[model samples]
Target: MEVAQVLHMNGGMGESSYASNSLLQRKVLMLTKPIMEVAVTALFSTGATNFPASLAIADLGCSTGPNTLFAVSEIISIMIDLCKATKQEPPEFQVFLNDLPGNDFNTIFSSFLPGFQEKLRGQIKRKDGAWATLPCFFNGVPGSFYGRLFPRESLHLIHSSYSLHWLSQVPRGLEGNKGNIFMARSSPAEVLRAYYEQFQRDFLTFLECRGQELVVGGRMVLTLVGRRSDDPSSKECCYIWELLANALNEMVSEGLIEEEKLDSFNIPMYNPSPKEVQTEVQKQGSFSVDCLELSEVNWSVVDTEFNPNVASKDGGYSMAKSVRAVAEPLLVDHFGEEILDEVFKRYKAQIADGMSKEKAAFVNVNVVILLKKIA
Candidate 1:
């Protein structure tokens, strides 16, 4: 499948839309907020006199929803507070929200931006009861981040949350990867090698592209799903896909899906270890890692004090909805839309059973890295 064309979070504000099901990603963002704050603060602390008059920021893979603007808002708020504390005028803000072309940019532009701007203006109102007019401009750029998306040296601060794990495309030559949809314990050595090689190429290209786009001393903070273990097929990263494959195999047995279809499909995602990511950054030679952290969040953490309405009596259902929001479009493109509900129904049951038996097994490992452009 052409991943760029097919891969997008389920759009619109429906129950199954990514906007509703993105609590996990939102939690990850909150967990990494301090790292982002530090990155932005460090950017200004390096040379306050040299701070740009118009600061440019990009949030890559910024899918539409509450989470889309969450990080951007946090970054801008940090800068505003820092400027106030340091007694410096805040720079005019230029914000870019980027994702694939198939993303629901309309929801963002029509439903969110106006309110965001109004609220931002209210926040920056002067003590004299006049508007400070911070002059923040928001633009939507649609494309894959695996390639160049901006003018050379145009960005000052870059942030991406829970997005980098997606490969540009499914790896080539995965005939040996029958019955499984992604890297799993049962996958062959060749299957593992192919996935890692594909990630290396894609990640190196990502670093190189951002290297070209970010000015010297610019900062980037990236948070993506990753595993702590060096083993590529560890359960922390691949078990979800394994459960999904089991669901598909069951359908195949029931003749709801053809065996050949299940055999041919593979998810275009990779959860790299911290070592893998550090190795690639060293190989790319464009940015210096300032901070690297590995963290974990329970898959069953559907409800929190921050969002009481998001709770689920069925943890499996909550997890299934999250996966469906992100994977349904890709699954529909490949397997036909008729099987979606049943597939997820079975997948949800599998998750519930697995979680009940082994509650500790259901955690998502995440990697958050702060980098500065040095070259």
Candidate 2:
């Protein structure tokens, strides 16, 4: 299935909605604030001499949430500060928020826009006698970032967070990938090869597409899930799936779901190493990789509000909610909605047990990269 047809962060502000359950993504964005500021500042520093009258910025894979607007605001704020520091007038801003077509854009537009526009309007207000205007406009562009989603050389700064690890679709030949819904330590060599190849194809295409859309010297800042180890089966990256598979297997034993269903499922995601990302960037040859840095967070540290209620056996439920917010829609499509609660109930128990043994946590590594389109 085309991911654009099925994949989206859960919509709206409901309990399981992406809007309410996206604290982890928010943390990832906050952690990268310095990098974002630095990249935007550097873009204007060298390119200000020929700066366009209007700045075009797109946040590709920008799933709807507070984080999306937070990113847009941060980028615009940095640009404004840089302009003031350089004694140049701030350019009118054209901001594009890109995501899959299935994303909850109505919630984003209805709830997020009024505040965002209000902020922009305030930025245009001047203290001095003379009136000045810095117009900033927001538009939603729905599509997969793996292919062309913008016009040629139309963007000046592009940003994405917590999104690129997702492949365009699940890799083929997963029938051989017995007992797992995602790549795991036990996955066959062929299954591994299929995933690696898909990521290679998807990511390079992403670079090539953006390369065409971004002006020469345009900057891009991307933060995605990644692994620190060279090993593809590293615990840091694959453990979550391992635990998830365990829950599925338990359900199978209880005859709650067909065993074949479990065997046939595979997740369309990859946690690439820094070397892997660098190789693709070098191979594509459209952008110069400026910085590749890794930052790690424990699942337990992601959201204080969602922390486990140890007294109530809620140890791993927060992590489960975070994962479900992203994965439930896909799982529901495959296994049917009737099994959703029960499946995660088993999953929460499994996660709690794993946490009890030795603090089970995600790799939660962010591969932060800054690239500049080569002229």
Candidate 3:
């Protein structure tokens, strides 16, 4: 599939929209809040008088949701607090929220932006002379973050969360793999090489682009799904796709889907290890890694009203909804919309059964990095 066109979070605030079904990603945001605070504080502490008159920040791969606003708000709040603590006049904020061209920007602008702007207006500000309403401007920049999106030396900070695992496109030379949508335990060695190589290329390009856009001392804090192990086929990274492939295989056996279609389908995603991320950053030769952390987030605990006591279909359903919101558009584009509900229903059932029988604890091992641009 043409990933950029097909791979968007479900639009509108309907039941399946990303806005409604993004509790998991929201939890991730919450978990990473402290990291953001530290990053923001460090950003301001980098020589008080060495700052620009205007601070430019971009949240890359910022999908439409409460999480998106939450991030920007957190950074703004922290920056303001830091400025006051340092007894420095706060710079005007230029914030950019970026995602794919197909993202639900209408909902973001019409529904979320107003409240965000009003909240910023309400924050008690330090008496920076002649300042009004905190002088923060928010704009939506729609495009892929893998390439250039900002002018040279325009950004002071860049942030992304729960993104970057998505490759620019599916790895090539996978047509020979039959009946697999992702890297499996049984995948050939060359398939793994193809995926790793693709990630290397794409990640290097990402750093190179950001390197040009960020000022000399600018920082970036990013959190993305990654693996703790060097092995790419570890369960932490591949189990979700394994379960999904099993669901599709069942449909193929029942003659609900053609087997060839299943074979041709592949997801454009990669979970890099911290070492892999560091390697690319170093190779790109533009940024110094300040901090790198790996944390495990349980799939079952990712909910708005998570009850640890209840391991029921409800949890399974919640997980399925979260995944569906992110993956449904691509599935619909490729398999037609008719099979969408049934497919997720089966996926939910499989998850429920797996959790009940094995007490399966699926996790996303995430890597949060803070990088500083080097001259």
Candidate 4:
């Protein structure tokens, strides 16, 4: 937990990413499939823990929403089926739904179905009551995982998505960017080196946390964006986010925004390669990759679909909607909401103008590395 010091929450890292998260559907799909296998394999793994009784689970960085529960729901669904097939008692369950403080835990917890109570009751009625009376409850632990958030060897399974790349802190030597260091990409080797070093550190801490928290042979599945290739110049493959960030910075020079605010508003994307992922896990000493999935999904121009509230006029991806989703609150944080409308107007055309069906075929980077804590 060396990252506990700098990687701890400084500000805004936990803010709402859902507003423009429409692009997450494809990544989520890719992430969910392999993990279904992991859940099933865990049930049958020779080293597997007893059914249901040993199934305490946690979704790290599970931002407050039903959306974050996609893997949670699917895994539980598979586990339930396994229980029925084995004719064995369901395992005791404890689900820790965690996130940063700025997350919406209240919204998430309040939405749990009453059937969950029935689910517990059903597991309890098992001939073996240990499966039922197990501590199958939900907890909202809000803070950086860089600090030891859970007790040692407590979790049986863990899942995280699109979250790991965020460095616990902006990299060192980014003093020029101040607290806004990770908001976008950089050209200098030091910037990229610092970013990678921070990830290695934060990732090492994450593995250390998992090492202490997971059971012998306990499992985990982590999915996040990554670079498609090692060649840095591949337009289709490398650094699409940097292009977007530059677009954002251009808007700053147009007198459309403030320099300080723009610089502080980082994109926080990570593009670790598959090899890098494998290396990071192996360095942790107790985990091994089960599967690493890279997924690519497409979008259509005629789709014209956008969430109603924040959507733009007529149709298409609303720069106002997209930018303001991050920028509005951001600018308002530094300046004031007084000019939110103006700022949106200033940059609306810039974002839309860049969206071409042939050129920028919008896509997401989903890297799912399934791991087993083999002690």
Candidate 3 positional error at 31, Å: 1.9
Q: Evaluated with lDDT, which candidate comes out highest?
A: 1
Off by over 4 Å in 4: 1-31, 52-54, 112-135, 175-186, 231-251, 260-265, 299-348, 357-361
Candidate 4 C-alpha lDDT tens digits along 1-375: 123222222122233234234334434644477566665566455545544345778888776343555666667656666666667555556788776666656656665434455654575466345454534566788888666778877777888876776557546654454323242333455555666777788888888888888877778888776657663223433333444445446656686556776655543335677777888888788887777778754333213332444343423244334334433433455456675555555344444554543335345556778888787
Best candidate, TM-score: 1
Better of 1 and 2 by lDDT: 1
TM-score of each: 0.97, 0.94, 0.95, 0.77
Residue 279's lDDT in candidate 4: 87
Clashes of 3: 0
After TM-score superposition, the amount by which residue 103's alpha carbon in candidate 4 deviates from its true location, in angstroms, is 0.8
Estimate, for each residue in 69-114, the C-alpha lDDT of model 2 and write its tens digit. 9898888878777777667777888999899999989988999888
In the range 1-375, model 3's lDDT, one tens digit per residue, is 888777889889998999988876777788888888877887788753277788899999998977778888888888877877778778888899999999998899899988988777767433343346677788999888888999998898999998899999999988766777888888888888899999999899999999999888888998989998889977778888888888989999999999988898888999999999999998899999889998877877665355444444365877788889988988888788998888899998888777676544477788999998986
Candidate models: Cα lDDT each: 0.90, 0.84, 0.84, 0.58
Q: List the residue pairs that clash in candidate 4.
A: 7-168, 52-90, 52-91, 52-92, 53-91, 53-92, 93-136, 124-132, 183-266, 183-267
